[model samples]
Target: MHQLTDCQLIQSPDDQAAYTSAINENPANAGTTGRTRRKRSLFNYSKLWANGRTLKIAFLDNPPAAHKQKIIAAASQWLPYINLKFVFVDDEGDIRIATGNNDNSSMLGTDALLIHPDHPTMNLGVPPDHADFDVIVIHEFGHALGAMHEHQHPQANIPWDKPKVYAFYQNREMNPLSKTQVDRNLFATFDTLSAVHTAYDRKSVMHHPVPNSLTLGDWEVPINRRISKKDKRLMRLLYPK
Candidate 1:
């Protein structure tokens, strides 16, 4: 995580305009587009109980103890709806510290997060403001439970102003224009409205806030705070009867 100053946080209207422009200017994603033919729901407890296997999760000792607690609490909210037990361990067993390298990818046998102790945001002194530890934990755990990125929803027709988003990320140094910055299969199709969705929610614990510069163009962001209807529906479906 990068430490962003208050000034950096304050994205100006002009900046927003420029970001939208960049998004629109960027070339359309070339790979397969549209919804995935095989739709997978978020969490359906009943079905999971019948067919799903219990998954063991252990967090590497990178994040602070407080941060770990927050992650657990957030997970508890959804655990009752799903049919798996989440276990946390102090030692590096199934999951290990995130080295930020591609080689150590399978630290967690199923799904897990590796926090780099040296990362500016993960380390002390950095404000724990933008990235909600609990939400991030739950979102990552969702992946461990076989959920994919909601933004990659196949049916999603994001009205991204490519140039604008690119410019916004560039200014913030969060740009994913190049293959290194963005995954090649990012635009590949998957059904976003499936039961596993955290709702069409921008504020859900599963969602990341769009840069202010790119908020205007066809992006539906939430004003208040709460999970989206879609999130609830998906959770029920994934863990349902």
Candidate 2:
């Protein structure tokens, strides 16, 4: 079994501001209908970037050259499927990366704009030497590209052993998560609109590795290292290049 790393999502501090930023960056984020009435609904907006735009990625904390190259390579895997471009830089960027910790996380899409520019929007805390480094990078970038966790898709129907699942994350030594965090990240399901209408894909890199121990019966989803076909299809639908 692949060792699971703590992959938490860093949401913008202010939902309203994040919504405004997302809609302003991409009008499609407001959805097709009810653009006027749904503006007040926190859950109605999508956090996608403007199609065909170039996203500048900046590295903070000055990680090793090799590390930066590996990150760039891993994140680039999504390029062929999407309409957007990525330009890595040393200065300020639309997506800021920081390393040197174990709690890997990223803000969902345009929510990065709501964060302090000096702070990192994404944390590549897993060391480059880790076996799943590339997978983790790809996963974070999936979030940066507006992909939500596949396990949270409303149609997933995972048979989770809630008590054991909660205990495992809460008691884990490295980057322990609270019950609320576990509920939000693991148990909460995404509505169809926010989920982008793709069927739940267990093999998607956007999914967390579900250990059999935390689930009822023999159900388990191993760590997904690469983007799945469904992932590509979903990206194509969202970006339509």
Candidate 3:
């Protein structure tokens, strides 16, 4: 079975953000499972990008012209709120993108610097039709900007139906991740000394959708397609003008 490689979850400061490397849904890297309580605060997962430098991005595989623009446009949504500039370039970049694959992920913050260009640091594998292209690119760029999954917030405790979650993703025709994989990518919440998170933003783009069946009682967060209002406020706080 393919272990899950990508998808945001909790992680220690020293470790690269979960998706910084390859994003395969294999089970090798996923950790133990259990539920934990999360307390809300201003969420900051990693060191912020150095100020006043354009974050360079390049697609090594040369995606279609329209596709490239779409990716840039989606990522640019984060630019207005944070102290970040997205500049497309011909040489190696801070975030290296690739296309025509199923594992969509990116390195968080300064971790992109550790990525080897030849290994495809980020993958825009799915086409617009099969996925919400705008949301996917924008969300990945959020990680590139040093953000983790809002769902994994220490204060934003989500009671996940672990078995149903494992079955749901595992049954997916493409990129079926095992239970251990789901535990790490979706259920595992890492404790961090640097987490400066705010109230749980249920509609934040960083949140993955939770089905009604997978959540107890009335708790259910739909797949958020746009950046939330809280996301803007938090970004401004993290990368001040």
Count of steric clashes across candidates, in order: 32, 0, 21
Clashing pairs in 2: none
Candidate 1, run of 10 with poorest lDDT: 3-12
> What's the best-to-worst order under TM-score?
2, 3, 1
Better of 2 and 3 by TM-score: 2
Q: After superposition, how far is residue 143 of candidate 2 from its true place, in Å?
A: 0.4
Cα distance off (Å), candidate 3, residue 232: 0.6
| Pick by TM-score: 1 or 3, better one | 3
lDDT of 1 by residue, 1-241 (tens): 4311110111113433333332232211111233556542232111112213444334543567675666567656667656556566655433233323211112111212222323211112222344543454445444434354455465445555666655544565432245323332233334422523344444444344444455455455433234455665665665563
127 in model 2: Cα distance from truth in Å? 1.3
Stretches of model 1 off by over 4 angstroms after superposition: 2-52, 62-64, 92-131, 174-180, 183-186, 191-204, 215-226
lDDT (Cα atoms) of all candidates against the true structure: 0.39, 0.86, 0.66
- Listed in order, each prediction's TM-score against the native is 0.54, 0.94, 0.78
lDDT per residue (tens digit) for residues 21-137 in model 2: 999999888776654553356876689999999999999888999999999999999999999999999979999999865568899999998878899999888888889989999
Identify the candidate with maximal TM-score: 2
Scored by Cα lDDT, where does model 3 land?
Answer: 0.66
